[model samples]
Target: MAPALNVELAAEPRSAARSRRATTEWLASVCGYASSCDIGQDIVLAVNEAVSNGIEHAYADEDGVVTVCGRIEHTAPERRPDGAGPCGAFEVCIEVSDNGRWRPPAADPGHRGRGLMMAEAAVDHLALDKGESGTVVTLRRRLGCPVSAS
Candidate 1:
C-alpha cells in the first residue's frame, strides 16, 4: 500500500452514494486480507454517516468539499508471511468541510441528531469542529477485514 490514501469530494448531497462506493472500494483494496463482513459494514456505515452529516449539516443546500484519508500501519517484514503478511490496521480518516452556516445541532431526541452519533459508534474515534462557514468532522476506523467474500 502507499503511504497515504486520499479522496476529495464536492458538496453534492445527492452524491453521497458515490462517496460511499469509493470508500467501500478503498477499504476492500487496502484491507483485502482478512475476511469479515461485519467489519466491512462498519466501515461503510461510518463513511455513509460522515458524508450524510457533511451534506445535511455542513453544506445543507450550498457547496463545499469533503476529504477522506487512509493510512496503513507498517509491520516488520520477517513477521509478515511470504513478505505479504498482514498490511496491518488502516486508519480510515474522513474530513468534511463546507462553506455554509452550520452547527452540529444539539444531540437531541430526534432523527437529525443521529448521523453523528451513529458515525461515532461505527468508528474508533471522531472529532468535530463548528464554525461560521460550516462544520468539519473527522472520523477514523481501523479495518481488520478483507474484501474476499466480505
Candidate 2:
C-alpha cells in the first residue's frame, strides 16, 4: 500500500524554505520520529535543492508554481517503495516545474553550484526535462527509513 501526497508551492524564491518545512511536517506526520527524521530531513533537503535550482535556472524570473509530489507505492520490501515511479525502493520523485524557460542552462557560478549535485547525490535517479511549458527536475531516491511495509 502506498500513500500519495502532492503539494504545489508559490513561485517565489524564498518558497523553497517553505517547501522544505512543509515537507518536514509531512514526514513528521507520516514518518514519525527518531532516525526517520534524519532520512526525511535528507529527502526534504534534496528536494529543496533541486527545486531551488529549477526556480533559479529553469524558470528564471517567470511567475509559475513549483510542484513537488511524493508517492509511496507498494513494492517488494527488499526494493524501493516510498518513491514516485513503479520502481519501488522507498524512492521519492520530486518535480519542480515552471511555465518559463524549459531548457537547462549551464551550471551557474560558484556558491550556488552544489544544489543539483547535492540533489543527485541524495537520490537514486535524476531527470531534467524541458518542454514548451517549462523545465522540470525529478529526483528519485530509495534510501533511509527502514520501516517495513508488510
Candidate 3:
C-alpha cells in the first residue's frame, strides 16, 4: 500500500465498532483480499478487542483518545537451499493505542478479562506496551497460504 491508514477516535463505546469498520475496509482495499477472509477477519477481531480495551479499561474514569494505525510491509522471501528464486511476501501491522494510564484488570473479571487473550489468539503476533503516559497494543499477521483474492 502506498499510504498508511490512521484513525483517531474518542474513547467511547462506539469507537470499537468504528475502528473495526475502518480497519476492515482499509485492509480489504490495501491487500486486495476479501474482507471476509480468515486473515482479514482475524485482524479485525484483534483490532476490535484492543480498541475496546482502551475505551473500557484505559480511560475508565477519564476521557481520552484512541488511535489505530495500519500498514503493509513487503518482505523478501526466504531463499531455499535448492536455489529457488525469491518470492515476495507481505506482513500486516496494526497498532491500537490510547492516551490514558494503564489499569490492572479486575480480580474477578468474569466475562470481561478475555480481550487480551482473544486478541493474542487471533493474530500471528500480539504485544502490549504500557508506559507512564499510555498503552499500545500491536497486532501483526503474515499473509501466507490460503489468501484468497477478492
Predicted model with the maximum TM-score: 3
Q: For this target, which candidate reaches the highest lDDT against the unseen true structure?
A: 3
Going through the candidates in the order shown, the clash numbers are 1, 11, 0
Considering summed lDDT, which 10 consecutive residues are worst modelled in model 3? Answer: 141-150
**Candidate 3 structure, TM-score to reference:** 0.85
Higher lDDT: candidate 1 or 3? 3
- Candidate 1 residue-wise lDDT at 142: 58
Segments of candidate 3 deviating more than 4 angstroms: 78-88, 145-150
Error of 2 at 76 (Å): 2.6
Ordered from best to worst lDDT, the candidate numbers read 3, 2, 1
The digit string of per-residue lDDT tens for model 1 on 1-150 reads: 533547677767666887777766766666663333666678678777877766666755666776666555433323234566674334556665555566637757565567777888987888878787566677776554432222
Tell me how far the alpha carbon of residue 144 in candidate 3 is from the true structure, in angstroms, after superposition. 3.1
Model 3: per-residue lDDT, tens digit, 49-108? Answer: 999999988876788999999887776565445766543367788899998989888899
TM-score pick, better of 2 and 3: 3
Clashing pairs in 1: 34-146
Q: How many clashing pairs in candidate 3?
A: 0
lDDT of each: 0.64, 0.66, 0.83
